[model samples]
Target: MIKLQHIYKIYEDEHAKHDALNDINLEILEGECVLLRGHSGSGKSTLLSLIAGILKPTKGLLEVDGVSLSKVPDDAATLFRREHIGNIFQKYNLIEDLTVLDNIITPLIPTDLSYSDVLKLADEALEIANISHKKYNLAKKLSGGEQQRCAIARAIVNKPKIILADEPSANLDLNLTMEFIEEMKKLKSHNKTIIIASHDDLLFQSKIFTKIIVLDKGKISDIN
Candidate 1:
């Protein structure tokens, strides 16, 4: 339920304009999993940011589940993201001093849910991400895989419809990358629309990915 039409992302400084993405046209259906595969600075992250409403496109239309994101107000886009998007970044964006449960429940803090409800969500998310055993541990004490699992738990705690992961396998070893692939498969089975941006062969090689979109020099090089 994602569509980009003639999309362009241009960053402008005082002296020059650089295009991060140019004339990007794509469609991702509900429940479909796609991989945005490219080297660094090839617009994969920029495209994912556009899809997640973190950055607006400079030209053309972007719609998620029929809502025109490019036209939405800033607050509206934030709300829409809260309601629909789940993100996993390469860096485990967890607070070092916060406990795992606290970190996972951070996203739910803005909602009107009761404390008990928030705890329930955090617990459930931890279970899904296989990080429940670290519930009370400080984030800084966790291992790399544990930290990544915590990030995944936090992202999914909101029960978002679309999952956007940028370079999820970038920091992990082969074994941990395989663990991530398994998690992705589970999410795909749950009918969540998934898109990942990475150059890691572990993710792109998986048969779970319905399609792979390759970007090079700010343009789409191939879609397979």
Candidate 2:
């Protein structure tokens, strides 16, 4: 579902030119769950960003779900990403003032779905994530694990084909980290392509991960 060939991302400014990813080649298939394991400055996050259209490579070819991401126009790519990719952030990225249900449906606001349809979608997502009980509560009132569940609901509400989770367990304790592992299992059951960039050993140790790709010095070092 994702392909990157000779991908190099170089950030250029007036003062310096820094390479974030270099000479990377990867191919991920449909319904495959891949874990990206690396320390800081290893380009794991950069690779995820490139796949999610959050960053563009300086010189390389990238394709996701068959589109030439490197050549797609910005406006088109944004819409395409919204339609095909679901992003789960480390901080949850919820609006503090919004209710859980409202935050879950925020991504649907851009679509042509009706109010009731949006509510239904959010309801289904909440149910899938086992967070329906907190649907009416404000985001700020929820616990860390609850907030993470809310983020998961918001992400899959669109039924995205690809799920990009960046350091999802970074903030959670062992218990909550285990909750995320269960959630990953559920997402995989739905046949969604999952890519995770993480430092958490819990995820790195999970048996559900089809492959573990290691990165170092801005390049892929090994795939286990």
Candidate 3:
């Protein structure tokens, strides 16, 4: 469902140029879960941003679900991301002032769906993420695991086809990490494609991944 060919990303400052990604070539099939493992500055997040159309590649081709993101206009890319890609960032990125349900329903606001339909979707997403009971709580009052689950619920509220997670377990305890991983596994059962950028060894140890890609110094170092 996703493809990147000869992709390159470079950031230029007045003093120097840094290559965030170099000649990346990757393909992820539908219903597949792929893990991207690497240390800091390894281009894992850069690759994810490229795939999600959050960043335009300096060079190369990118296609997600047959739409060529490399050629898409900025507004089109934004629309495509909203409709097709679900993102879980390390910070959870929840709106602090919004209730859990409100935050989860934010993405549905731009759609023409009725208020009842939006609420239904948010409730269903909370159920899938196992956070339905906390629907009315303020986001800041939730625990770390609860907040992470809330992030997942918000991401999948639109039933996006692809889920991109960047260091999702970075701030969690062992138990919460396991819980998050299990929740991700459940997503595969629903035929959603998941791509995770993490250095967590436990994730690599899991046999659920269809493949694992390692990045180093802005390029792919290994694939298995």
Candidate 4:
């Protein structure tokens, strides 16, 4: 579950203030697959970051799974993100030299799980992302699709409740993008709350999305 009430995200510097999001009020129920469709600078990414606990709203409340992220300290937010959020960025944020398996397990390094347990989770995630064969390959050596699979594996390895993907298909081909849509469908079947921010037409046309929200400038322009 995610809720945002009168949320405002403003970036202010010495000379000006830019509003990334303004007066956003939204609530996403559990297990819902939602699409955030907008052009560049439409506040889609900002909303995802706020829900993922990576950015605190400058005004109003933000709650994810009942936790008030806007009021928490940075460390607490980080912990909450690790525990409940899976973020897939547009640019695959993998360590260049690390192997795919190592990268997948990186998020688990901070937990108290034993080495074997960590490996178990990583292997399961790799299987789900269909990147098990490339598990030992270096991140820098993987192809675009392979790298995308690696990123997905890493994000879901924690088994997070809410999956936030920002422009996930930006680098993939049509076939790979279709594969991603299927993957998202699988996750939805597993009852995960999925939110994706992208302008991809394929996603908008897909049947998996339960709700489609279009943002204009810094506000919700339409919801379907």
Give the TM-score comparing model 4 with the true structure, all chains together.
0.97
C-alpha lDDT score of every prediction, in listed order:
0.92, 0.92, 0.93, 0.93
Off by over 4 Å in 3: none
Candidate 3's displacement at residue 182, Å, is 0.9
Candidate number that wins on lDDT, 2 or 3: 3
After superposing candidate 1 on the true structure, give the runs of residues whose Cα lies further than 4 Å from its correct spot: none
Candidate 2 C-alpha lDDT tens digits along 151-178: 9999999999999999999889999999
For candidate 4, lDDT tens digit of each residue in 72-151?
Answer: 99999999999999888889899999999999998999999999999999999999889999999999999888898899
TM-score of each: 0.97, 0.97, 0.97, 0.97
Report RMSD (Å) for each prediction in the order shown.
Answer: 1.1, 0.9, 1.0, 1.1
Which segments of model 4 are wrong by more than 4 Å? none
lDDT of 2: 0.92
lDDT, candidate 4, equals 0.93
Clashing residue pairs, backbone N/CA/C < 3 A, model 2: none
lDDT of 1 by residue, 1-224 (tens): 89999999999999999999999999999999999987889999899999999999999999998889999988999989998999998897899999999999988888999999999989888998999999999999999989989999998999998999999988899999988989888888889899999888878778889989999978999998
- On a 0 to 100 scale, what is the lDDT of residue 194 in model 1? 93
Top TM-score: which candidate number? Answer: 2
lDDT (tens digit, per residue) of candidate 3 on 1-224: 89999999999999999999999998999999999988899899889998898999999999999999999999999999999999999999999999999999988988999999998899889999999999999999999999999999999999999999999988899999899989998899999999999999888887779989999988999998
lDDT of 2 at 173: 98
Q: Report the poorest 10 consecutive residues by lDDT, candidate 3.
A: 199-208
